[model samples]
Target: MNQTKKYLVVGLGRSGVSAAEALLRYGAEVSVYDKKTQDEIEAPLVNYLKTQQVTCYLGTDPSDLGRYDAIVVSPGVPLDLPFLQKAKTLDVEIIGELELAYRLGKGNYIAITGTNGKTTTTTLVGEIFKNAKRKTAVVGNIGIAVTSTALVAQDDSWLVTECSSFQLETTEKFHPVVCALLNITPDHLDRHKTLENYAKAKAKVFKNQTEKDFFVVNYDDPVAYHLIQECRSTIIPFSRKSILEKGVFVKDNRIIVKDQSQNEIDICGVDELVIPGQHNLENALAACGIAYFCGISAEMISKTLREFQGVEHRLEFCAEVGGVRFVNDSKGTNPDASIKAIEAMKGNIVLIAGGYDKNSKFDEFIQAFDGKVKALVLLGATAPKIRETAERFGYQTIFDEKDMGECVKRSFSLAEPGDTVLLSPACASWDMYSSYEQRGKHFKSCVQELER
Candidate 1:
């Protein structure tokens, strides 16, 4: 990257702010823009940007983008916006935060993307690398912006980044040495408008990889499997069912990997995993494949798997109140993710679900209930829609609450002694909270407040 380059960073979100900081650190001039007003923006961020001498355009779009060498867009900003279209006409390079990080960072990257399980898989891979005593940073959609650590990354460092469709959509040359796609399900339909467009965006992770690079895909997911045909990277697959001739799978209750020589290596038994659910087993398999390719020993992979409990907000056990377990799966913000959460439950479930409606259908989620969901406690903007869907499925035990506290109480009331109260909202948390982490924390607080 040229030090004299001028960058226009659109969006004052975490990723955008990080990009501006990174650009300034690289000795480049940067101008930050956000649709939000100066007062609406956080005080700390505003003060920090001012200190860095970055130009700020708040509550409005910049009159001209041609002055900058390139425009860095945050994941939340839509590409179809009029200003972005104008930037395109100006022939100004428009790239995402991830792309900016890639352009400036020095390291081998292992990027994971899917509608679900990206965080768990990325974190697991990061743990494996760290356990091997490798320098690693887990970033992207998992929380920390990649730009935060990109400048400090060494050639030997491993960046386990969780790429989202939103980030992937704007990537042009953001390549990873190792990339994995957990599964592709209907999600972010409001943004992409179609599953094809969404999958295309996800496929961008491998768009710049060569044959020397590795792409780990989920063999069990048809969408993920189908994408293999378009990848130029060496394809490595992981499956929950069926043994593969040259990939990772479960055999005889053990996690097995088939090397390039067609030799079978047993990593560990499925029971050894600290994380619950068949979905996590798939995640473990993907992590194993990535670790194996990265030269991480099976023992290290098994050790990480055995000790890794799981990522927060994804089937995290909050507290057992009145003999009923309260599980917070607030990260299950989509139907497919919620389906996996529901399937992972053992006892009868009192499910607290529904949030911002992403125009997603509830038929599949309701079908997965399978008599295990004792009662459905709906909330948020999509409560009525989910209730209507449940009724159509002949499910009568459904309740709706206006807030998280009431929803938790309602679920607890519906649960029996041996039952589980799961807060697995099958929609995004934007309707009620800033992020899923916030929603998950509030749920935990509510559960902790339950009278013993």
Candidate 2:
């Protein structure tokens, strides 16, 4: 409860740097440390830290962390690290950057967390609030760090945060007035060690909430649904399969969002959603639930849904050339997500997939193919695995490449008129790219080069 707390920021990545800067602005003694050197933390804004008199210990000794009263860890850093253990022994409170931001934010929040669709739901909810003329800010894992946004929060503003399991893992007293726990899936298992652990991490968003808070959850998701039974907060359930008279539900193609008083509003029909796939319909449902609960009108919600442009790198259409439509869905990092992307495609598809395999089961992809995929263009470390799966499934047309450019060139070669060329890699892009953004940009670059 110190007014001018000494904060130690671990992991100088996007979240880490933003949190450090915010702490300094608040008159807190800020120091940062990371395993990487100054050159490795290549953010241009991080260089400004030195001018602001912020202490930086990049690629330095762990002993430096022992001096701070509290530690704000980056989401990427492992919770079981030796430095974290040392900090705990010394009674230094260790928390994530989101937790720090939550403590600083004066406005009420609508926090969204899940394995997938968090960004979509968060963005949609923010848009609804925006259309209603509410002062709202969308931050968290989607891009802008919450800490910086909180510093400029107004009395009428609302924080619509998209939190990841990594951010939720270290949260303390970061309760949202209205929390949305979207569908939980088997993702980031490499970091969480198990599916159960990942679910537990996501559930932490509502762990400390009181009766005044509300939790919006998907009743169709087993893990998420079961967790709701254990939550102390008031629960409002939603589903794509069932009809809920008192909560958000789908009935005859239209999404009906109902409150406790049985008052209802139809935001839009599933067929009207600009974004494709059943998963996106579900995302829209979750967003409508969040927006309606936050007091956004039905009219504004409908208008925003009609005008909302879908998130980039997730089943986004690039262009049509020579009657071949190109899609960039580099955000599909798991087999389930990839399956959804494929299911959303029209006509014959030349799929460009494969990256760093995390030992996920490709059986879903194999079964979902059902002759829809005209040709399979594989790349990165998981090319062999994808090829093996395709071969095992008796898929006749399969091509392997080392990188994105080769995959695009080969896919174009095999594609005919009315065929879709999709870059929906069901694996992490770390093998050949920095992140999914790089993978998506590279795919677009190759497609443009081919056009030229």
Residue-level lDDT tens digits of model 2 in 1-452:
46577888888778998898888878888888889887877666556878777787788746755678889999888888887898898888999988998787578888999877887888889888988988899999888888989878976779999999999999988988899988887878778889899899999999888888889999889889899867998888889999986778998889898888887777787778898888888888888878877778888888888788888899999988888999999989888888889998988999999998777768778788878898898998988888888788788688888778999999999999999999999998988887898999999999999889
436: Cα error in model 1, Å: 0.2
Quote model 2's TM-score. Answer: 0.95
- Per-residue lDDT tens digits of candidate 1, residues 330-419? 999999999999999997999999899888998999999999998999889999999999999899998878898998888887788999
The whole-model lDDT of each prediction reads: 0.92, 0.86
Which candidate comes out best when scored by TM-score? Answer: 1
After TM-score superposition, the amount by which residue 14's alpha carbon in candidate 1 deviates from its true location, in angstroms, is: 1.3
TM-score for each candidate, following the candidate numbering: 0.98, 0.95
In model 1, which range of ten residues has the least summed lDDT? 443-452
* Model 2 lDDT at residue 184: 82
Which is the leading candidate under lDDT? Answer: 1
